[model samples]
Target: MSVPELETLLVADREQVRWITLNRPDRLNAISPAMLDELESVLTASADDPSVRVLVITGAGRAFCAGADLSPGPGDPDALPDVDLARSDAVFELLERQPQPVVAAVNGMACAGGLELLLCCDVVLAAAGVPIGDMHANAGLLPGAGGTYRLPRRVGLNPAMWLLLTGRTAPAEDFLRWGLVHRVVAAGELTAAAEELAKLLSGKSPLGLRRMKELVRDGLAQDRRTGLAHALAVAQAHQKSADYAEGVRAFAARRTPRFTGR
Candidate 1:
């Protein structure tokens, strides 16, 4: 099924995967205030829709995103953007908090806010040689989303510091080594690669995936002992779930499990 027509994005659903493509190729997919609104709506819908088991984000043309629209608008010609920065940042946050897994297909350049956008995804796959960086420094701006927070956690502080401070775009391969990108593929294969990975995730137990995501994300903020305790609690609860029972029965029967997500 199609989503409401969007000016700045395109949507395609297949095999329980909802693919969202940034449609502003002419603008290098630079996110405007309007795009943020449309994107937030899509993200919310994807989260609530049971058919959407995996979400993939990519961009049209040669770039993933150039970041936020900093152009002058009717409200204030001098202001960077008339949009509410907090509201705009919340859109990215919504993506981060999605129940199902989110995959980022970085086809090309991803800078400034673009970098922050991808940081929220659960899995990231980039085109080989694709340029990526925190262009905020280059533009005399700062990331309003979770860029500063999530980037360091994924790539470690030293690498995050260099990228955030220098604003120098590097090939996606560098990020793969730094543990930010999960894989780097040829430019021509980016979408197919992302969808393949999404397909693998789509068949998993929904409740199990959701629980594990919440557990790991929440545990990142706790000490080792505390995190282990939290995991134990979660395990106890999960064992009582329908999916867990089905999994064990399937193993005994030597057949695939049918997860009901209960």
Candidate 2:
């Protein structure tokens, strides 16, 4: 979809890159049930599209995402709508299951559910002033999203514990030091930096990149021997692919390889 068709969110396609923006600038791009549903659908749809080589999520306003919308209404409880977690499972599933890479351009405060979304992305780019926090416990609410699980894996137990327990906010620099974000750039430079990284990642063999993400995610749970065996199988499969041959040929010709992800 082009820029105008985008309503609550904007989906822009530029040379195999799909840029998704949370368009609720007035509310700091808060996560409403409808927003969550749309985000899941869009990401999942992009996952199946071979034309989309990379996916980037960002916010339209100054803040990336301020967490769930606590607007008052009949269905709204404690500000957030009472949508079943299952309804938005697609968001987490798409990120963890998709073959294409996902990046989050966290330009502003990304807290609670917003932070969880960032955690699911393969690469995270936060602006210098943006603060990342997990405030579920502080708010007297458990993380209905993926926060409870993914946080520890990304930032490790001790650091994750400190943040989770204290409900403290961490700046971009702190996250960079702890390896939460891939990079921290200036405010206006966030999107460009993220896109540059996406382009660099997209230039590689699509299948290789996909498999690498899958293995890295899955390997953490597997024993070393089993992980090695799985790695060998994946490596062998890629070695036999037509794109592998094309990669070799391109190297010989000193030209850019056109990977079909076969």
Candidate 3:
């Protein structure tokens, strides 16, 4: 599918993997009103496009995203429109609910809202030497985009508490150790590594990937018995899909399965 023109986002599709780059390099890709609007529209469109099997989000310049644009451009008539921070929650929600897996490629600094944005992704890969932190505390504010809930789940409660309470930045390696990041690579290899992972994901059964994502995400909030029941129900339903029959036939034939995502 052809990508729509967007002022704040650069969209590219390669082998069923859609890469969305935050394009305001001068502002470190900070979240502005226009950027948020464009992002939401693009994400919504990508979700509905069956051709897009996976998505990777990254920034253009020195940072993945510095955070929200809170500074008013005083005396500058060309300033961006006032950002409605509340809309950020909706954007994050849209990302979480997408059928395709979303990966965050943190090329550099990811703080406050930027870090929160990464937390919404299913997989997170960061470049070495990148500084990551929750800076909401430093600004006398709290995370408004599911950070409080997602952070604790990504890292342990203690680490999440320390990061959120202090708003101190740490190296990407620290996050990798803390289990917040899936991989840490050299800055020059960040995009390549993310694309490699996206390519691998794009080759999987689209229905299987979507169902597995749903099972894990939704099961996390359920009791053990309830989670098991849901998993069984999902498995049973998947057995009736064409992909499952193809998988079985391929196993019997000793060949790779060609999943049509039916």
Instruction: Give candidates' CA RMSD values in order.
Output: 1.8, 2.4, 2.2
lDDT of 1 by residue, 1-262 (tens): 4346799999889979999999999999999988998898898788878888899999999999998877787777686566566976789888888999999999889998889998998999999999999978886777788788888998999999999999898899999999989999988888789878998888788889999999988898899999999999999999999999998999999997877777
lDDT of each: 0.88, 0.83, 0.90
Candidate 1 regions off by >4 Å?
Answer: 1-4, 74-79
- Please write out the lDDT profile of model 2 over residues 37-72, one tens digit for every residue: 777678767877888888888999788898887677
Worst 10-residue lDDT window, candidate 3: 77-86
Pick the lDDT winner: 3
Cα lDDT, model 2, residue 244:
91
Per-residue lDDT of 99-129 in model 3, one digit per residue for the tens? 8999999998999989989888999999998
lDDT of 3: 0.90
Q: Model 1: how far is 121 from its true place, Å? A: 0.4
What ranges in model 2 sit over 4 Å off? 1-6, 74-80
**Model 2 lDDT-worst window of ten:** 1-10
Better lDDT candidate (2, 3): 3
